[model samples]
Target: MADLEDEPQAATVAVGSLDDVAPPPRQPPSEPADPAAGSLERARELLAAHPIADGGSGLALALREAPLYDIEDGERLLETDIPRLRDGGVGAQFWSLHVRGELTGDRAVTATLDQLDLVRSLVADFAEGLRLAMSAGDMADARNCGRIAVLLGPVAGPALGDSLATLRAYHALGVRSVTISGTRWTQRTGLTPFGQEVIREMNRLGVLVDLSGCTLETMRSTLVAAKAPVVISHHPEPVPDDVLRQLRANRGVCMVACTGASIRETADRLDHVRETAGPQSVALTGAYDTGSPHAPGLADVSCFPRLIAELLDRDWPQPDIETLTWTNVSRMLRDAEFVSRAMQARRPASTARPTPLDA
Candidate 1:
């Protein structure tokens, strides 16, 4: 297998433009650590020095220099191909076990499962370099070992075969979370009614209910019905009519921002999300958010960096960066055993929601 740094390139990599989130002066096998740097500072340095970017994208993508990784041509996991990314920059990945089945059928589910199996294979294939992760603890351990932590989950649950049992099966397979309904409803969860059932069951099982692809009603339903904590895996979405379009959040559940880039509106949207989901419930996107070559760094995370820096440049509430970055998701993971008695203490005895979100 080709190592991350060994991939084919168009050129020897050049310094672009800070306006463009410029790339670094030269491409080296590994980078040296900045002697004096905070998290955000480190992010900017990565972009400013990155070989792929010419100028800085912006603050949004500037938080960290880790390269945004993508699944390769349906087979190989290319961690080494992107040396910068594999070097301990990326914290967590929602390795998309996405079933292409939105309106299609079982084929989509099968395809999604195949993607998951590929991930499992990649675990062994890249074991020395990477490992599968579900809880924050697993991610922490992986990071400690200098390995990439892959958080696995289905893009949507309906593709899991049929009922909640299939969902449970996937959970057993190490899927810490599951986006129940896709852009629209399907077999597993009805338009809205079944959505409620799915959320409730997911909550009880301690499985994270993902509301990234569901409709506003579905998002609302899951937020309102969840027994355990839930996450909006792909929200702050730029797509029209997305229920969690901007920064809408529900009380209790945490909202992690994810769209194309973490830009301006994202900050405003995230503020609103924090207001609704509670200061502890709202967070911005952490990885793969800067896939656009046009967006060079964190500031370009949607032009939201300045805003994020203005609002949360230092810190925000939640369980600290680790929790927002990996712990919260890890808490509900099926494979993690690091849950403190405190976490169990914080969990609600019932799934009843105290309030509905306005997103």
Candidate 2:
């Protein structure tokens, strides 16, 4: 994710009812005159026509994307975006809380809290269209209820303020994963010793480890520490062979972000990954952001079907596509959730608060 300005401290917070908080107004539906509507609609149509996984299997999931609302810019999801996602056949989104480099110490934690509040407010206001999901089952429930499952993901573990308990608090608060340092906005190259400890704690806590912008050493060390499958939500170009080998051993999924590249280039990368890591190890991700300019033939979430359609046009096997689109990530989430439950059971009574959404 690209760096952005830090969110200012909230003067007052409303954690009560949805009636007390108001989200940014939704953007109007896309019309034919709109710049990207025609292509988006075509992709949506193709997505609906193709049933993902067939035989009533679960829906496809994306690993990373920015939140729908931009508090700094007063921008919100366009009215067409939800339909675009549904049409694109996206069942769940790990809406990322990208911590800017400027935020540090207490400010970082405050910023994370603010983003969490913002997403919760949006979900509450748009309950008909969205659900706050903490686990794979919750995501499936949202899909069954005809809504998008929104999971919390914090990028840059510095937001946890150098505390393992703080990390557990984040887990209790429903954060499913954390990216350990190295975001686009930061000059921070490698994980600190404390950062490594956080990874070990995350494994014990059943929280997913995210290696999005980490250094090669960071990825290597974290992969070794993590007991559960970690996710490289967005891979940088020139992916390392050793990292691929580690991921193959860890059973991790490398989500290929669909931006700034052609379908063929993306396909070639996935093919290369398969050749190196074997099948069911690579997945597709839009890393979609309403704020950024659209990638050709892949603009918003709605462009997903177009990707699948193009892959099919290339004669990619349907089963492999199914693994890339759905199963691998789903299985990873389930594995993490199981570990989380076991950890929660072993936790002390002093930590006996209800999980987020339950609280």
Candidate 3:
């Protein structure tokens, strides 16, 4: 994940019900007509046809701090809302379940559960616009129904409390993705035997093993161990070109985090990722509501189309853009599901625990 070093401190505010929230804010004025209007319109048309299936979002983490933050109305206090999501042409989103690094053991598990509850409640509250998606098919169904598919994932591996049982429980509760390393575990030399077991269990359960903040050793270890395709939800700076090539061989996806300070820079980063890692391995994620600074014109969820327009202006082929926005991530999910079924048929879930020696 991009550094949240500049994350704005959450204000102390009272919680309120969705009904008490104000009506949706007025839409901002459209940009003045320009020579690029044709590209912008084409971009919108392309997105309308193949809306983005964003690989990661931190809305749940933001909402954890401000429970009353409503998305129905254009909640300026936060980065995401229904109207903005619709405006952004986001058809699916992976809501990251992240807790502070200091949290561990039962505390971490409980905090993660709270984040899950918050996300589930938000989905329930906004059922008309959001639908929980536990599978690739569900995501496609939600998109067809004109609802944003909400996929849940834990951004920190510690949230599992080093227990496969807890991990299974989370899967049962609808977590489709789990980061293999977090702040505490990222420094490890490589995956321990137990860590390898966790990877196996996650594969059997069809959960995406996210290697966002993992060390190179850990990432390589996971790539070797995982039967299902893994995902890097955010751009990890430490990852070199070789790792990307390895990722391509592993049939994984790098959901490039668009953390650039400007739309053009973001497009450049995407292009670079596509070139380094094969086009099939590239995907897009805004990291919205993660408390990270966003580039101008890409400051909120509504700005995805603007970025797409920039890509169009760069003469990127519509097919490539379609692959970036929807195809790659969706295929990764479907591949994971396919691998999971085969793995489950071969072996039952392993009963494994980490030992001090393993650590």
- What would the per-residue lDDT of candidate 3 be over residues 1-359, giving only the tens digit for each residue? 25685787686546877676668989999988785778788888999989999988989988888888878887799889999999999999999997877888789889999999989998998999999999989999999999999999854788888788988999999999998776343446878777888888999999999998888888888888888888988855735788788888888988877676788888887887788888888888889988777887798898898889998888888899998998888899899999989999998988887777455
Deviation of model 2 at 1, angstroms: 96
Residues 185-271, candidate 1: write the lDDT tens digits. Answer: 323233344456556555555566666656665555555555455566554353232333232333233444433343444455555
lDDT of 2 by residue, 68-185 (tens): 4332232334322565667668777777776556888789888777776766777787787778888778876877787777778744567866566777788888888787654221
Each candidate's lDDT (Cα)?
Answer: 0.47, 0.64, 0.85
Q: For each candidate, give its TM-score against the true structure.
A: 0.58, 0.72, 0.88
Better by lDDT, candidate 2 or 1: 2
Candidates' RMSD to native: 18.1, 23.9, 20.2
Segments of candidate 3 deviating more than 4 angstroms: 1-33, 183-187, 236-238
* Model 1: residue 106 alpha-carbon error in angstroms: 2.2
> RMSD of candidate 1 to the true fold?
18.1
The TM-score obtained by model 3 is 0.88
Which of the two candidates, 1 or 3, achieves a greater TM-score against the reference? 3
Considering only N, C-alpha and C atoms within 3 Å, which residue pairs clash in candidate 2?
none
